[model samples]
Target: MYERARYWFDNTLARGVTALIGWLAVACLAVVIPVSALLVWTDERAPDTAWAKTAAVWRSVGQTLRLGGEVGSPLRVILSVLLALMALFYVSTIVGLITTAITEELIALRRGHSTVLESGHTVLLGWSDQIFTVVAELVAANANQPRSAIAILADRDVTEMEEELRSEVGDTGRTRVICRNGRPTDPAALTRVSPATADVVLVLPRDHPQEDAEIVKNLLALRTAVDDSRVRTVAVVRDAHCRLAAELAAGPDAVVLEIDDVTARLVAQCVRQPGLSVVYQELLDFAGDEFYVVDAPDQAGRVFAEVLRACPTSSVVGVAGMDGTLRLNPPATSVLSQGDRLVVIAQDDDTTVTTHEPAAFDESVMANRPPAAARPERVLLLGWNRRARHIVRHLSGHVAAGSVLHVVAHGSESLAAEVRAAAQAAPALTVTFGPGDPTLPGTVNEVDLSAHDGVIVLGPDHGPGQASPDDRTLVTLLLLRDRERTSGVPVRVVTEMTDDRNRVLAPAGAGADFIVSGKLVGLLMAQISQNWHLAALFGELLAPQGNAIHLKPAGDYVRPGHRASFATIVEAASRRGECALGYRTRGIARAGNDHEVRINPAKAEVRYWGADDEVIVMAER
Candidate 1:
């Protein structure tokens, strides 16, 4: 019996303090009511009347009930004191319970329990380091709208995500960003963001080994949860082989980008032609001129060349068919069918207007076109990384048969083996590797830098026992610049930087072309998020088999040192089965100046072209 009583006491005390207080209040009430009733019955304040005893008992009970009201006897006073103590205990217990409940609810709120009621907002379905860039771009894109919102759903702490966004993207202008904690692949979690009502969905690939698989699963989940076909979806898949699976899961209406393929093609193009990445960045990012699809009913039956002359503010680059076909720089004689859209490059979507007045063309200065030269190239590659193999393979596709590529890196044997494996698919060009550290001046001097036609510097991948990747790249760039200054060699240098901020710190006179990986991906994703049709457009432009952007000699189209109108240049390029977009003049190309490489210059304006000036064109070869 004693052991049972002890167990009962321990269990009762182990109950929460609030529960103990609740039990104490009940016990106090039980004792206080009976004690007050007994004191009322034995009160000696009765008068010599028939109802005098009943009245005295009632008065005693009332005094005790009022929590220590005026008492007439010693017994009544003691009961009142006990009743007051009980009331204090009851009030304290109620306050404690209320405080505990409030704390728990606050914690739940911090964990993201509230549901979003926003409609027509952009929804970001995953999280990574690229989120900052994506958010900043979206904010700028939505700056003119009075009310814009971006909701992020990720499997992370809500408060932490908010704090990181606040630190990275300070002011959002009129845009509001909301964060929720949930697994993107879970259907139940997706409902919290109201995907059915969203304007668009962007699935960011997570930073993990199984990132592609996770992205496919998330895309499937989003497809299953939303029934609206009007809402557009964009996703990124890292592996090329997994792109088919992701596309199948996302359906035909969705856009799925292959990260490796795009990056490889971009690096290949940039390495071959310097300043190409800058043009791509301007086209992809919203801060500058971007591609927009606009209806041109007035020119439905007009030829493609006429459409180019009609748009003064915008540059007509391509045509988008109603059947979802994108033709960039198609044949000039191709007729624009009814219901077709013109893919034009403009500062804003609303700024793509067609002017009725046509600019006069100078047919007198137009000259016969010359055949493209097939000169052998001697290229030098500094350092090695994961993208080096892709760069080499793509470079092989663009160079002549007798061109040679020399690779200088730390692990020469391993890099050579990898290059050999990559080159087996394309055996036209020869590749060789040498052992040396390109960042050191002595090692750089050993290799004859003046002999190469172009130099491509790759950022270090591992950075083991060395500075950061960007720091190492900067050192190599400085060394190469010094070499060029000493030798007076005019070798074009193309560099890869992991961070975008480091691009600003590079030497000004070096004339190096910077390709920032993260920022480039972020810009592409942002552009596609706004318009899903751009995915296929960019894919076709970057693919090796389709029409690609090229910088050819301006002398090929017009006479050297002769003044010719831009319209005459366009007409000349059309004769060669190509489309002329812009030109880069000799001694005029700068790092950050966009006008130095002018795109969509006035057709009537006559300008003298130098012998070494390059004309930017879109061609299949």
Candidate 2:
């Protein structure tokens, strides 16, 4: 019985520690009021001390029994001890409640439950490996701003996200990154990040099978919460088929990017013309030159061709019509109307200015060399992955009618079926498949490496539930380099890697065009996040059905061994219905090195042209 009473007392005391404020108040009063009553009743100096002694004793006893307090006699002393113990218990309980409340608040903060109160901030919705790149780019873009903030909303712990960002992105000068934990598709969760007042909202596609659908849902939720028409939202969709649906859900103004289509088009373009990827990186990445739209009112009545020569530091590639139409590489005769913006490529937006004094064009150096004729060639593909199908589809459209393609990879009949379907869609190109492990040197030697005009190494599947897909790709590249060295055959190699870090480890002297898929996607996402309108510009540039970046032989614009000014070359390309941005010299196709390919060069500068040198242009063909 005694042990049971002790257990009950301990449990009751623990319950009291976590009790509500009202219960604690009751406990305090139960000790204080009773103690006061007992002290008053036990007073020896009574009105009728002699006769009322017995009555006072009885009243004190009743009060002491009802409430724990001090009284006269031995019974009163025992009650006093009990009352002191009760008071101590009440104090401990209050302290425990306060401590518990503080601990819970800290836990909530760590969990990213708090609301973010920031204005004119960039809101990034979702978390993935791409967040680091996005954050780093934003930091660089906002370097001149006095203060900048990037609020992130993802279903992750705040501390973890912050730590990872700090580890990856390092220092972010004046930009502050705020993390909030919540489901991106939830309206209430979206509200916590203050999406309505945000300058831009970037929705990163999750790495999952249903990423496209999830992106659509997140866009819809963000749209519903951010009623402000000024708020710009950009999202990435993995599948091209889901782009229209995502765009519809995100509203007419929202920017949606198709990852597979963009990557596939880039691969196709890069394979045909080496070092073209570097040109794109220069225009897309924040570290280098980027595209900007600025009002050129002074040159309102000037022709597009004249505007190209007017900007000595900036390359005037296109014009954005006043009616919200973006025309890249328009005809030279097309006039820039009032209120129309010029699409320029420059180191910074401030550098895209028009010079009143135009550079002198050397008409003596201009030559009319005809464009090269299309020729059928043989191509080899090493390994296959998710992007293999899209690459084949885009390849068929770019290659000549009778071009042949050979795909070699270690796969069952399912992959062969898919490749066959891709081939059927593009009847102009013939594709054949062979089963072999592309990573092994012996397997790669079975094919005639010298016979193929170009070799494309596709990034292989890492493994079941594996992350790094570039390991096998690197091995294949090494073996290919060995084979080429042994056979003394020179072939244009364009390899795809999943991670950007692995690009640096590629075999030296291989002269392969390394296409880092994630890095490219991240750059595109970052560019779109900064300026939502650029999404339309990028969509048109990367799409297979629109005007894309091309490397035409310089001979088409000027005669070989002739010295010509850039202004004359620009005029020559304009005559051919193409916009010339810069030129890529022969025997210089280094990746990430912009010295060989000069973009937005000075119009007055003269250079000797070669027949093999190519002029970078934006055209349909």
TM-score of each: 0.82, 0.83
Which stretches in model 2 have alpha-carbon errors above 4 Å?
A: 1-95, 227-230, 461-464, 508-510, 586-595, 608-612
lDDT of 2 by residue, 1-621 (tens): 999998876766677555555566677668755665566556767546543554454455545444443456777767766786687679889999999999999999888878889989999999877788889999999998999999999998888899999999999999999999999999889998999888888888766435678998998898888875557778887777788889888886678877767777788788888878878877878887888888889998888878888887777788888788888888888888889999888888788778776666766666766776889978899888877888888888889888998999888899889889888887889999898989888888899987888888887654547867677888887888787788888667888876677889887343457777677878888888777657778878887677888888888888889999888888788878888888888665456332377787777778889877889988876
Error of 2 at 487 (Å): 1.8
Clashing pairs in 1: none
Which candidate should be chosen as best, given TM-score against the real structure? Answer: 2
Clashing pairs for predicted structure model 2, backbone only: none
Could you tell me which 10 consecutive residues in candidate 2 have the lowest summed lDDT? 62-71
Error of 2 at 394 (Å): 1.3
Instruction: Quote the positional error of residue 388 for candidate 1 in Å.
Output: 2.0
Lowest summed-lDDT stretch of 10 residues in model 1? Answer: 588-597
lDDT of 2 at 257: 77
In the range 1-621, model 1's lDDT, one tens digit per residue, is: 999998987788788897687777678668766775566556575465645554454455555554555355768767867887698679879999999999999988788767789999999999876788899999988888999899999999999999999999898989999998899999889988888888888888655325689999998899878855555888887667678999888886678877656676777687677778767776777887787888888888888877777776677878899998988888889999999999877888888777665545666666676676788888898988777777777888888889888888877566678867866765767887788888888888888877787788887763335666888888988887787788887557787776677888875243456777767777888888777678877788877788888888888888888988887787778778777777877676355443356776666667898887888888886
